[model samples]
Target: MSAGWIYNFPFEININLKAIDDAVRAFSVKYEAFFKVITKSLGGLVNSINFVLNKIPWFVLILLVFIVIWRTSNKISKGIIFSSLLFLVGVAGLWNLMNETLSIIIASVVISLLFGFPIGILISTSNRLNKAVRPILDTMQTMPVFVYLIPALLFFGLGKPPAVIATTIYAIVPIIRLTNHGIRQINAEVVEASLAFGSTKLQSLIKVQIPQALPTIMTGVNQTLMMAMAMVVTTSMIGATGLGMEVLIGVNRIEIGRGLVSGSAVVIMAVILDRATQGLVQRSEVKTDGQ
Candidate 1:
């Protein structure tokens, strides 16, 4: 009759997640040397990108962006509007911070493509590997983004390296999943016909499978880029410097204006990237269809 008996009829079990954490920590420490090399390499890459971005004259970079937008979209008005939005970030005094954010994103997306595309190809060729990797990708995508920061911090420590590591982990899934999906979605008959016509496995994959899958793969790239951008603010928690850091500072200091402006800059950049990438994807699909 007691409320406890009626409402709390349950058993308690505890999982030793701390033990897993401890194991990871121990492993990280045990292989600290290797990790340091990776950390240093990644830091260098981010710095190189940041330096290049920062060195570009503001007007020149804006013009480049306008050109890209114009070419991809085939719309002069959209190019003008997007370029103006980018210029507004400079007007708001966040251009340098935006560049820093772009540095991190470019580095992360580059690394993601380097690893994800090949793994995706391998997995697509083998059902067993696909089955094995599918659940792992699910875990990665479903796992809280915050959890990625932990391993990243342990492996690479603070600043751009860890930021890149965490962002890459979060963003890479889409490309891998989509690459495999895209390739697998190809017609088996098409692949077989290529083989029958003296196309080597490598040739078929390179020419037929990849070209056909390009649109889907490009979609994955767009998603990966977006996810990397989404991580910018989160990575700021670990000392990443960028528009994200500005937002964090504003939040901590309760400066509504600062946070709002920085957040808006981030949005503007994201919108430009998303639209441009989608336009390219559509163009690729049209080209592929026409072929």
Candidate 2:
């Protein structure tokens, strides 16, 4: 009976295959055009940014980072922590690679915010859309990071763009989810008071909700940055040149030291970003409380 059922299942399988084939054929042109536009535009934008940023001397960049640390955290201890990571990256001779990695991470994080935050806002405004987007966010968040590489490579063809594409997809989810969560969690009384005070919908959202929710949203951004860093390493498999590539090379050549060094560099980067962003979020919360 089992064998007979298996034989009959081939018809159902064929039907499913045919449906998939038809769908792919129907959307192939649309997908191709979309991919071309995104990959080309994003690739060009990142390359241009890299060109300008790369021209700045490393010393200047280091000084700027330290300045940012001091201004944001307002503490010598935090500045030292930030400086130490930069120093290690320089000493590892992975400075350039780390910069490239940073470039990609920055690009992805910026784009993710540009795109994710709006979707989050939109979802927050509509229960129907929120319901619709929830499952998609679940899938994006839950899917294994490596699984995205296949379709990403298929569409963007293995380079910084593809890696960025993959990284953006993986990293964007946290921001979207958190933004929605934050907006939804805004104090109802505050919202009501704003509405009572002749606040327009936009004004209420901007003044009351967003200001109150900024800390939570920033937390989401922090998570997005961490996830982006992780994806950058995975993306190196597809010709993303960075510390990730170093780790990939080490693995391929069975050089444990190379992998360990690159892996540590990535960890350092993650820690620095996480701490900096967390500090910023904390500062924002404090400011909001003071107000």
Candidate 3:
């Protein structure tokens, strides 16, 4: 009465997953030089944040951030709200975790911009490259984010580096896509006019394209930041410490109060970052108005 034969494979596949894993481990060991370069880059970024956190008193850092956000936002109320939320994280006793989360976001965004912008520019220049890369970017954007952690852990090992490597991969697509779109969307007439002035390609790009694309680029950055935070809690599975870990521990212990408070602090951070970046985009538009 049970037809199990229809559902099962006809033969045993005998795939050696353990061997595959060992091969990957051997590869990482064999290429330590290549690995070290990336490790240093990731380490430097995370370490710089710890350096700042160690040197600055928490209250002083809050004041400084308030001043910068207030001035950049061009709104005192927005600054006050941001500062108050930052303080609330401390009151919630998640200040250290918040710092870890913030550092991770900043580091991932930095690396995203570092690689993504140049690759975007390269793609924008060639229809062939654009055609080839678009599908890859789509895959990177759509893949289950958790899938990144396996290779990330294999190559970078755990703790901050793999967490960052995973996050950077997860968050990088938006910047590349948006930057390429922004550059390509510029008026053909403007580009032609710049060349008519006998400008070299690099000159035209630096003087015209990037300035015009600033708003869109900033928007990509904002999206990347949000995406990075979205992954923070999940990345904690691989030795990351932050608001993510706080939530993880809370869940394991059935501590709903802890989970809610830590999660809310993350939301507050997201809002402040979102609003601040939006202000930058608006300002960029104003600057580009006449051009």
Task: Please tell me which predicted candidate would have the highest lDDT against the true structure.
Answer: 1
Cα shift from native, residue 98, model 3 (Å): 1.2
Residue 5 in candidate 1 has what lDDT? 61
Predicted structure with the largest TM-score when compared to the true one: 1
Give the lDDT of residue 101 in candidate 3: 85
Tens digits of per-residue lDDT, candidate 1, 1-291, equal 556865775666798999999999999999999999999999999999999999999999889879989988888888899999999999999999999999999999999999999999999999999999999989888889889888888888989999999898889999999999999999899989999999989999998999999899999999999999999999999889999999999999999999999999999999988988998899889878985
RMSD of 2: 3.1
Model 1: per-residue Cα lDDT at residue 189:
96
Alpha carbon lDDT of residue 239, candidate 3?
Answer: 79
Model 2 clash pairs are: none
- TM-score of every prediction relative to native: 0.95, 0.89, 0.89
Quote model 1's TM-score. Answer: 0.95
Error of 1 at 218 (Å): 0.7
- How would the candidate models be sorted by lDDT, starting from the highest? 1, 3, 2
For residue 288, give model 3's deviation from the true position in Å.
0.6
| Full candidate order by TM-score, most accurate first | 1, 3, 2
Candidate 3 lDDT over residue span 114-217, tens digit each: 99999988899999999999999999889998888887877887788888988888889889988898899999999999999999999999999988888898
Alpha-carbon deviation at 219 in model 3, angstroms: 0.7
